[model samples]
Target: MSATQMDMLWMAYGKAGAVGSIRHEDDLFHVVMSDRREIGAYPTLEIAKGALISHLKPGTDRPEFRRV
Candidate 1:
């Protein structure tokens, strides 16, 4: 998938107020974010994206997805 698609997925699963960015280390793209005042680092973009979505509360506003 495209980088933008991956970013969107990551944002969807991230916690409230979380922000994500792509960082390169050792020739790999890492997805990292802040969660509850702690930093969460994911080895794979897919995992990071999943974590964000899985923890979301019901009826949460997803403005990024236009579901607000």
Candidate 2:
């Protein structure tokens, strides 16, 4: 990840409330839940966001990602 990407933070929110976060590190994007469970690392931000959204409970709305 580049310097700018490394400093960026993305918050994930779903119908249930705060779901997790996305951060760039070691050239990959990681999705970490509020409970501290790590989903996995992805090659790009879009993929990371998709993973986070997909991790939500069934019938939940897609997560809203906000940059922080």
Q: Pick the candidate with the highest lDDT.
A: 2
lDDT of each: 0.43, 0.86
Best prediction by TM-score: 2
What lDDT score goes with residue 9 in model 1?
A: 31
Query: What are the C-alpha RMSDs, in order, of all predicted structures?
Result: 6.9, 1.5
Q: Against the true structure, what is each candidate's TM-score? A: 0.34, 0.85
**Measured by C-alpha RMSD in angstroms, how accurate is candidate 1?**
6.9
Compose the digit string of candidate 1's lDDT tens values, residues 14-67: 345544443434434444443442234567655545554444567655423211
Tens-digit lDDT track of model 2 for 25-60? 788888998899999999999999988878877888
